[model samples]
Target: MTTKEIAQKYVELNRTGQHMQALEDLFAKDAVSIEPKGTPTEHAEGLDALKKKNEEFATMVEEMHGMEVSDPIVADNFFSCTMKMDVTLKGMPRNHMEEVCLYHVKDGKITSEQFFYTPPSMN
Candidate 1:
């Protein structure tokens, strides 16, 4: 798949709440995920580790109110999109969070992904 194809599929899966499926189908085996500094799961290397990170995150979510993913902007072998989610964590108040997600594609698979977002205050 081309970068545009991968990006479009990713956005479609995410918009439909098929995040894990997207990861499984689109990411390379050694793909890396980078989160903002100071976050609990700041970086995950390898598809397995990324899957584990996602699982752990799911355990922390009390409820998911909604999720949205914007159409991707493709450039060369890279693409970017905006993701917004409204949710409440186990011990935190409900909040809406938005993030810009950038992904790199190589050999028709996602090689790496980096996320940019301001985390909501736990209080």
Candidate 2:
């Protein structure tokens, strides 16, 4: 599958709440995920680390009310999508959050993801 094809399938899966499946199927074994600087967790390397990171995120979510995913913009082996989530986390106030997730594909699998999102308040 080409990058555009993978990105299309990824977007479709995410819109249908099947993003975890996409991750398992389309991400490379050595994929890396990066969060913005100054966050509690910054980088997650490899599929196992990705799964652990996702588990951590799930543990923090008290509720996920809704989510909206944007169409992916593709360029060569790169793609990007923006997602808005309405969620409430354990011990945190509920908020409408937006994140721009950028991805790079190699050999038909997602090789890396870097997310740009609103930083959480520590107050």
Return the top candidate by lDDT. Answer: 1
TM-score against native, each model: 0.97, 0.95
Q: Candidate 2's residue-wise lDDT over 1-123, tens digit each?
A: 999999999999989988679889899999999998876679999998888888788888899999999999999999999999999988889988899999999998999999999777746
Any residue pairs clashing in model 2, and if so which?
Answer: none
**Candidate 2: regions farther than 4 A off:** none
For model 1, how does the per-residue alpha-carbon lDDT over 1-123 read when each residue is reduced to its tens digit? 999999999999999988899999999999999999877789999999999999998998999999989999999999999999999999998889999999999999999999999977655
Q: Give the clashing residue pairs of candidate 1, or none.
A: none
Kindly give the number of clashing pairs for every candidate: 0, 0
